[model samples]
Target: MKLYQTYASPFPTRVRLLIYAKGLEVEIIEPPGFHASTEAKGDYLKINPIGRVPTLVLDDGRAIPESEVICEYLEDAFPEPSLRPADPWGRARMRLLSRMCDFYVVMAMVPLFNLSGRSRRHWTPEAIEAAAGKVAEALGWLEDYIGEDGFAVGGALSQADGAIVPQLVLAVEWIPSLFGTLDPLPRLPKLSAYWRAIQTDSICARLIGETRDAIAGVAAQAKAQAATSGG
Candidate 1:
């Protein structure tokens, strides 16, 4: 099996977290025709018509899109080091957290993403404030649902951790840089504690480092592009 993904994206990063944590043998490759300059097209669209990152292609040639579905497929396909909780309610909790990351957390971050970095000048002060407010509301939801056990769903590392941690890293860096807002995670006690504790896990730490590095790389590229074009 192979996963077509980009390191810069949280959606793909979540799938990667599961791959790394489980020691899966799937090959990781960038989607064809996908880059800062271009969207996924041509060959990539043939494999997964959605033209999105983190598309898993099975050896039998079936394609899976969307991070949540991909993660569930991986967990089911490679069940040795199971990421799902053993109990029914625990599994439900795991799915709920993952869904929150999808529906609430990532959705809130969308506006900030639109207004981030060089795009800030294109947006008004009022627009930026509203975007930041939406982000804060989403963070509040996370604070309410998050467990005290350091993991998202259960006491151990599960699919929930894979789902949420990458987005948290993005929020930690972007909330302050883009919105001039304080680090909201630190203000939310449970989330702050969860963030601090999760980083101690080597896989989590590695993925976090990959995400930060990817963010930096993108920033540098943007700077270079802006300089070249005299923006």
Candidate 2:
């Protein structure tokens, strides 16, 4: 199997983590999408018309796109140390939490990444503030759902944990001063701890290297730009 991916993509990171956890051996090709280059765009589209990263090309020449679908396929193909739960309710809960992270957390960070020079002008203060608020609300809901439990769903490191860990890492990367901190959302102590724990795990640590520094670079650039614009 050949996995095409980029370092900074949360979606790809999710699949990488799953691969690492399962100890699956496959060829990894870092595509040019990370540098915003067009080289991989054409070639990747031939394999996956959508041109999305984390596209898994199986040994039998089958192409699999989308992170969730890739993870599900892995769970089915390699059932040892299964990530998905056996019971129906457990499976439903894991899927529900995964969707929450996908739609709520990952979707909310899309605007901030568009704050480049030309794009920044279109990023209104109202819109940025609104997106930040939505992120906070979503984090709070996640924290409440987590309570004292160490993991999401049935309180184990199931598919829900694998799905959410990457998105939360991205949230901290794009919005460093936002969720996971004590001041912004005080009720998220458990969630904050969960984030810290995941960071130290071998699979997550290997997948997301020097994450704090990477996030700091982006956040610092954004903060400096905001100060210069006086908006």
Candidate 3:
């Protein structure tokens, strides 16, 4: 099995964490997607038409795209430690939380990434503000769902929790000024604690290493450029 991934992609980070947790021995291929290299765009697309990173190619030559789907496949293939709960309701809740993170939290971060130095010309003030607001709203929803539980679903470390870590880490790194000091949603003590706890895990530490700073530097430079251009 081979995993094509970019260090900066939250989607890939989720699968990488799952692979580590499952103790899977798959070859890790560094995709050129992170730097917007044409190789990833052209060659990768032959494998995955969407041209997304974190493409998992099985030894049998089957390719899997979409991070959540890849994680689901992994969970099914390797059930030890069981990231997804056994109970049907529990599984549903976990999937719900994962989708919330994907569609709400991750999607909100897309605009900011588009505003990075490499893509700064695409950023607009209106888009940034809209994305920021969506992020805040998504955080509130997560806080409500988490309540006093230590994890997102089943009251334990499950797929839901795993799915959220990379996005939250990215939020803290890219939009620190917005989510760091300010308690945007003060009622989310459990969620806040969960974030802190996940940060200590080695899988996350390894997968997201350096990318956070790199992405932040890109965002900062873009913002500076936008300001200069506007002035």
lDDT (Cα, tens digit) per residue for candidate 1, span 78-187: 88688889999999988888888889888988877766545445668787777777777788888888889878877988888877888888787856775677677767
TM-score of each: 0.92, 0.80, 0.80
Off by over 4 Å in 3: 35-40, 118-127, 177-187, 205-231
Give per-residue CA lDDT, model 3, range 162-216, as digits (tens). Answer: 6777677666555656333333434556678877665565765565564576555
What lDDT would candidate 3 get against the real structure?
0.71
Please provide, for model 2 over 82-188, each residue's C-alpha lDDT reduced to its tens digit, 9 standing for 90 to 100: 87778898888888877888887767666655543223457576766776677777777677665245566675567677677766766655464543222333457
Per TM-score, the best of the predicted structures is 1
Clashes of each: 0, 0, 0
Clashing pairs in 1: none
Positional deviation of residue 218's Cα in model 2 after best superposition, in angstroms: 8.0
Query: Could you say which candidate leads in lDDT?
Result: 1
lDDT of 2: 0.69
Better of 1 and 2 by lDDT: 1
Ranking by TM-score: 1, 3, 2
User: What is the descending lDDT order?
Assistant: 1, 3, 2
Off by over 4 Å in 1: 32-35
